[model samples]
Target: MTETARDRLIVGLDLPTIADAEKIVSTLGNDVSFYKIGYQLVFAGGLEFARDLAKSGKNVFLDMKLLDIDNTVAKGVENIAKMGMSMLTLHAYPKAMKAAVEAAKGSDLCLLGVTVLTSMDEQDVIDAGYEYDPHTLVLRRAEQARAAGMGGIVCSAEESAAVRKIIGPDMALVTPGIRPAGADKGDQKRVMTPSEALKAGSSHLVVARPIVAAAEPLAAARAILAEMNGALAR
Candidate 1:
């Protein structure tokens, strides 16, 4: 599918307060249409904030990364489905994935399986007692997610091409750790440029600090969107 700039980008609202999030949205205005509300904002009672965004016609990607038993995760998915969210994320464990798929059966919610965080490298995977490297684990979990009927997988751009080859064309690949050229990598270990990630078959790019911490967040977002549009055109 052909994607517009807004369709391919997701801005992460990792701020601590709803007021801060409101300010950012007001600053960006219609330039941004998709927002990710993760644990920090949700823990700060940003559910109402998220609902307001949805009511204003913005897509909400709830990135809580649900990890729990099948029953609990199913219940959680059911609850979120009623919130008019566009997408929801959960760990790519088989039982959790199956439950999530079942819970979202009648809703418009897209269940995204988080394969591996962009912040973890091979050594970190080893330290976590995983026998495989980061790339290998991402592939394994992605396959599991697809098999279990997830809408997509959350992976880094570094592995997006390989994942695309594995999962085929229809599934979504939401990539994070998107750094512009010369931008700080922060705590992210597996990172890629916005164009690189798009070329590697990322369906959507999740960018936070680069845009949020910029001297001018609107300009930063516009530049990234232009970069994404360029990549899609190629």
Candidate 2:
């Protein structure tokens, strides 16, 4: 099925408390249909909130980025699948991806392999003891994710085009660090505009601070959705 701008935009609920997250969701209303619950919100009773959002027909991307021993990772994925999570992320380690895939079988969960973070640059990767640069490593992880039967990839839009070639047309290519034109880049080093990210082959864009922290959260979300619509029109 074809996607709408609303479907492609995954707002990151990166708030410190459940009240803040709930307030944003209520404010955004039906204009925003998809949400990403990351570490910050997840710690503050976001899992139950995530399940609640799912019950209300909102798509939830549970961004846990799980990485652990094969048994541990598989066990977690098994439960996340039952939680009705639309999507879940795990570090793009071959073993973890493989285990997650096996655990998520028979469910609709899309297990995403998180590649190098957008906040990390070549220096940061090297500092972490990686030989390859950021781009190369992202593609390598994409390949590994595909080989392990992962349903999608989580990568910076900067590498979406190259990664798309590796994962092909069906797999989901979810990108973060999406800064709208003229917006603050903040700590994101590989940020791209929403239109640019979508045109670059990103299937979904995860936005947080721009909308969640905006003075008018709904307006900020509408503006982004407009931009995404414009891109999809082309």
Candidate 3:
């Protein structure tokens, strides 16, 4: 099925509690369909909540950023796939991604290879013991993800266009760190407005604070969706 703008917009439920997540979900209503459950939510009974959302016909992106020995990674992927997750993220390590791809075979789960944290910049990459800068490293990992026969990539929108060229058209390019125009960027160092991210080849845009932190959460979400639709229409 062709994707609508709403379909491409993934709201990050980066809240601290499931109740808070529920409140946001209720507020967003039908205006939002996909959600990302990362560390903050995962520890607070978010796994079951993820299942509930999926059962209710919502797509859940489980942002675990998983990395481990091959067997452990494969085991986790197998269970997460059974949870009806639409997407799962693992650090872009070749061995782990290969194991995850193999384990997720025959499942609907799309394993996303996380290239680098959007909050990190050039100095951060060096601090992490990487010789290459953020942009170059993101592309290198994108290459490995493609070779692993993985489903997609998680990258900053800053690198989406280049990553898209490397991964080609079919793979999902899920971009996080999305900020609307004039919105406070918070801790995210790399961000793009919804339209800019979409035009740069981001297949899915994950937004958090811009929507959830707004006094009117629903309005913020709708506005972002409107911007996304406009970009897509153009």
Instruction: Report RMSD (Å) for each prediction in the order shown.
Output: 0.9, 0.8, 0.9
Candidate 3 regions with alpha-carbon error over 4 angstroms: none
- Quick one: ranking by lDDT, best first? 2, 3, 1
Query: Which wins on lDDT, candidate 1 or candidate 2?
Result: 2
TM-score of each: 0.98, 0.99, 0.98
TM-score of 2: 0.99
TM-score of 3: 0.98
lDDT, model 2? 0.95
- Local accuracy of candidate 2 as per-residue lDDT tens digits, 116-161: 9999999999999999999999999999999999999999999999
Q: Ten-residue segment with the worst summed lDDT in candidate 2?
A: 1-10
Residue pairs with backbone overlap in model 2: none
State the lDDT of candidate 1 residue by residue for 1-234, as single tens digits. Answer: 338879879999999999989999999999999999999999898898988898899999999899899899999999999999998999899999999999999898999999888889888889999999988999999999989989999999999999999888999899999999999999998899999999999999999989887899999999999999998888
- Please, what is the whole-model Cα lDDT of each candidate in the order they appear? 0.92, 0.95, 0.95
**Global lDDT for candidate 1?**
0.92
